[model samples]
Target: MIDTSSFQGKKAAYYTLGCKLNFSETSTFGKMLQDIGVVAAREGEKADLCIINTCSVTDVADHKCRQAIRRMVRNNPGAFVVVTGCYAQLNPQTISCFDGVDLVLGSNEKANLLQFLSEKWSGMSSDAGRNHLHEHFSVKTKDIKTFVPSCSRGNRTRYFLKVQDGCDYFCTYCTIPYARGFSRNPTIASLVEQVEEAVADGGKEIVITGVNIGDFGKTTGESFFGLVKALDSIEGVKRYRISSLEPDLISDELIEYCGRSRSFMPHFHIPLQSGSDSVLKLMHRHYDTALFAEKVRHIKSVMPDAFIGVDVMVGCRGETPEFFEETYNFIDSLDVTQLHVFPYSERPNTSALSIPYIVDDDTKKERCHRLLELSDRKTMAFYNRFIGKEADVLLEKASYGKAMHGFTANYVRVELPVSESLPEYDNSIRKLLLGDFNHDKTALKATVI
Candidate 1:
């Protein structure tokens, strides 16, 4: 073990991969290390310690984790490489095999990272027995009961407040349940406190994020609607956004409340993996296409200008050209603002991988391109409807091209002319006059009122 007495004022760098929950947990861990006088350092800069928070969402995640570790070791050969999170919990042995990975802490052990480091550095020789991270590691999920305020690095106009963790759905194509374990949530009172704290910290908007946010409070008996109502009562928070939610969980009360809630933003992201009922059944998704369409209609009936984002996974097992066309047509017929299209990736131990009629890589690529083209059209049409209208934009920082950017309550991306008077952080809002979409509809440039 390296001696802690000699490590005072040492530098540390952290790299996080995966969902908002992982980002929040990394921020919390960063703060814990900071309290012990470990200063946060840049990625390429030499540091005494490096912590990598990993993900296991897709096959790409594994490749990315290994690449990141190799790069970090190359940059800081002397740094103690510590790996943690879902990937580490699921495949500790694989990560432990890396040459520079001096320590591997699983989910539960992550909270005790500082203690582990101290013990390792205090007169503990780097013997073969002490160096075997796989033998000393433990993986277990902690019972989360409190909300943590975490925002992305750099100047983020919006922050993601992790209100829930873990999933119980066990969908055929998902390994999130096994990687994250059972569902858990912070108490309503705790979440409200965190929201207030975020607002106090100058966050204009908060997106309630989680692994399976729809299943929130199932163990505590509090409904998602109840959480929304409580959050609405909190003053100073300008906008509240719900991350991706299940269609069946979108209740009538929640839809109506969103229509009238002053704090709730007019945006919703719902996942609809497939439109074919047979495919959905085999995928183990709870709701069918009709039910999903009904939920979208209900939300639109109340808030016509609401921005609806849909998640579609194409070219999964059993997804023939005909089956895919049905999904494409359903999405085309919907009044969605945008689409998050993902080509299905086979995951280990997933039922979908073992199913027959696996889609070829070429087919998946073609389907992905088709849906993306449709998404561009839908997004352009959605943005066109608001052209020449005035939107209350929470002004953020100047971008790479010296263009100032922000977002409206409806979640439209707006870029405004750079001005000295515009607010830099959470301190300013501008009444932006919307303009025509640029050649690429990814961002809409606007004029400041």
Candidate 2:
């Protein structure tokens, strides 16, 4: 009942703000537009349409989403602007009120974006249709059940495969479950097919991403381990990295399997929101400090040279001075490669609000700075251990200054000089001898082996 004629020769500009999953979904939207003969707008060129995918993890993220939507509208004159993702799903009416926004879609509506656009475009010429179609779009969180599949590179050498969507954990300070809905995922067979397609398209490395990837089998009867086994069997993939996993869900069997697997790298990212067991309990986290420490020890025991990244949130409700000290000391004792430190941002309608203690903005900022400084030391220490050693690195296409960058199998950043004698090695795995730190000390300088 819709005409595809209108879509021909259209150019769209996309803006995504958030996690790897958002970027993957945006790439899927780009492909959908391409299927209709709509290409991406070139730099400095005005677009006929603009799609902005948003995030609402924190109030700061919500502010950024609003700013992005406004900037896109201002840049693309006369463009039909569409907004979707977490921010839109949670606060649809607020975004709909924005002056230049044409349409707003939530998580439930995101998968059927093309269909929604068709329905809206069919009647835009008439005043009645324009008025009726110019509202926000989203179903209740409970109604969001569909698991849309996404496997995309998104202008990167490493393809991000979305193995799962949504989450079931309703941690007191978290709003992800409310925005993304209960946990769900596609069948293992379908995911394997996606991986095969990515490989055929020249993808060498894949980072399995999700809201909670370890809880992958919520919809299907398949376990995360089963999915891992299925993906490992695929050919052409040189490296595989599990983006993030909960400590409790990271079974010892899985750790040992990854250690012995052919493709899975010696890198792990696990979140330990607060190192204080009391604070973790207050945050409604599933795992305790003892269990988290045990997991870290187990990982180091099996993969001695592995890179372990931990996520630490500071100054949440009920986190007193003593608690913050507990967190800092605990992290200092761990052999983590780096820390991803976040200052707590209070979300609406959450159990965290009921807690009596509150951390002032200045205190939160101070705690974040302290943790980040600690992170720098830990990261530098990890990089120093690999100096003068040869490791296989997957060269990425991105460049910084006069240097090119790539990541080793253990997730160590390596910098190579841009020399006339050197051949182009983008997207190719090559062995490199790690040397001293780069000019900025952000990565290890390397020479091709």
Candidate 3:
């Protein structure tokens, strides 16, 4: 119904703001624009259209979105700015108030951008008239499972394939459920086919990423274990990694699948949020600290060398100093390889904002620093275990200052001396001798065989 004939020679540039899902959506949008004869360019470059996929996870996301729009307008004075994603979905009116913002498309309407743009182009006589389309293009959220795969850019050995979107859990202090809507997952067969295509395109690794990866099978009655099994069965994939998963979703079958499957990496990133049961209850998380610890113990039992990463948020409401100490000590006692510490940032319309006893900023900073220091120690210890042992590394690229750097199977950063084999070794798994303590003990330098 929309005319694309007017956009034949036009160009567009895309910018992504948040998680892997945002990147995937940006890439999909880029492909859609490209299909309609719109050339893709880098951000800050002169282009007819600038598409920005925004995020609303943190309070700073709004500022970043606005700044990006300003920068785009500065570089290309007359460019049309199309804003979509979480920030646009939740705060379209606020985003539309910006000076250079020409279109504010919500998450549901992002797919129809090209169609809308084409329709606008047919109606507008001059560039000045196109701004009116912003008001008309505003869309209400609809129930549709539009699985558009993101195009992989950059020299990434691994590609993040977003097989799912949205979240069902409305945890206090979290705005994801409101921003992304309910959980929706693609069919296992479709995902397997995507993995095959990625493997064929020379992607050495594929990361299964989503808002709530643990809630994958809840909607369709297809378990996360089933998805893992299907992806593990795919041929030509060197490695596959699962992104953030909730503690309750870490089942015995999933652990067993990782242990037995050749392609699945022995690295799991499960979010624990808080270690204190009382704090976790206040946060409205599903699982307790005991259940979470049991899950970690079980993973270690199955794959002892598995790189376990835990997510902890500090300074949530009602988290006392003693509670934080409990969290720090609990993480220190665990066999986790690393810690991803997030200093809790309160967002608008979240339950945590209403809760009393919010920790001071200084106390939150201190707690974050304490956990980061602990993380340094834990990561170094994990790296030291592989010292003097040969690790199969998928060499990525040559660093400008340091030598070639890549990741091992267990997700350790390994750097090797620059050599003739470096180019051929890129994206290929090769054996390397991991050396001891560099300037930072956490990372290990290597020499290729």
Which candidate number would show the highest lDDT if scored against the true structure? Answer: 2
The count of backbone overlaps in candidate 1 is 6
lDDT digits (tens) for residues 358-391 of candidate 3: 8999998999998999998888888889999999
Stretches of candidate 2 off by over 4 Å are: 122-133, 398-401, 420-423
Pairs that collide in candidate 2 are: none
The count of backbone overlaps in candidate 3 is 0
Q: Write the per-residue lDDT of candidate 2 for residues 104-183, one digit (tens) a residue.
A: 99999989888887877532432222232347989898999877789988575899999999988899999999899999
Q: Please write out the lDDT profile of model 1 over residues 305-350, one tens digit for every residue.
A: 9999998998899998899999999999998988888888888888
Model 2 scores worst on lDDT over the 10 consecutive residues at 123-132
Clashes of each: 6, 0, 0
Q: Native-vs-model 3 lDDT?
A: 0.79
Error of 1 at 337 (Å): 1.4
TM-score: which candidate is best?
2
Query: Which of 2 and 3 is the better model by TM-score?
Result: 2
Instruction: Judge candidate 1 against the unseen true structure and give its global Cα lDDT, from 0 to 1.
Output: 0.79
